[model samples]
Target: MAAGQKLYPRATVKKIVKAHSKCNVSKNVDVMIFLDYVLFMQTLVKEAAIDSKQAGERGISAKSIQKVAPDALSKFKG
Candidate 1:
């Protein structure tokens, strides 16, 4: 939820995503590109609380992440 501070580290996110969706996250480009946003989402919810559908929502996708990333990144850390 903060700069250089992952609310959900990549590995953690990948694991949760895999568990919920039964889909490996390491193989996706968009998911990779949008991972930061997904991690950021954990700040709003509980740890590993975000589901794949939520992560894939238009508002949280790669296209929208850039718009919100800066704020999301700073919400918790600094």
Candidate 2:
């Protein structure tokens, strides 16, 4: 996905950009951080969905998450 089309909302990106602007980091580094943040958030969403789904049953499994969020599974698989 494009950096601007990250899972995070526009407000979140604006906040992060504003926070990083105070530092002297290179634009390249900022972009890297932004990508990492997006991945982290996507992972969190996947994990949370799996956890919630499994909360009422046996332990969570990858297949369950795949059924719930196919794109999320594809990201990891790809």
Candidate 3:
């Protein structure tokens, strides 16, 4: 999918996180850190056509992404 398609859903979540606080994180755990970051997870949420579990195994938590994307978060059945 397109990169914008990958990034849009989590836009609000990203904004929320940036507004909250600054964090000091290391690049050694970049993949883990990036996925766990709310903004990044939101990006995954946009790709709902893909299975979320697979994303998590790759370090992107679909469940976490569902939590941050405003639209997904609100309509989430689980």
Pull out the clashing pairs in model 1: none
Candidate 1 structure quality by residue, lDDT tens digits, 41-75: 76544322333245665334444545555666677
RMSD of each: 15.4, 10.1, 12.5
- Which residue runs does candidate 2 get wrong by more than 4 Å? 1-27, 57-78
The residue-by-residue lDDT of candidate 3 on 1-78, one tens digit each, is 866565344455444555664653343343444545665445545554355554545544656455446654444323
lDDT of the candidates, in the order given: 0.56, 0.62, 0.50
**True-vs-predicted CA distance for residue 2, candidate 2, Å:** 18
Candidates by lDDT, descending order: 2, 1, 3
Residue 73 CA displacement from its true place in model 3, Å: 23
Choose 2 or 3, whichever is better by lDDT. 2
User: What global local distance difference test value does model 2 have?
Assistant: 0.62
- Model 3 residue pairs with clashes: none
Local error of candidate 2 at residue 22 (angstroms): 15
Best by TM-score: 2
Q: Please report the candidate that would top lDDT against the real structure.
A: 2
lDDT of 2 by residue, 1-78 (tens): 876675646555556776867754454564666677688667856675677666674655665565556555556552
Please provide TM-scores, in order, for all candidate models, with all chains considered together. 0.28, 0.40, 0.21
Model 2 root-mean-square deviation: 10.1
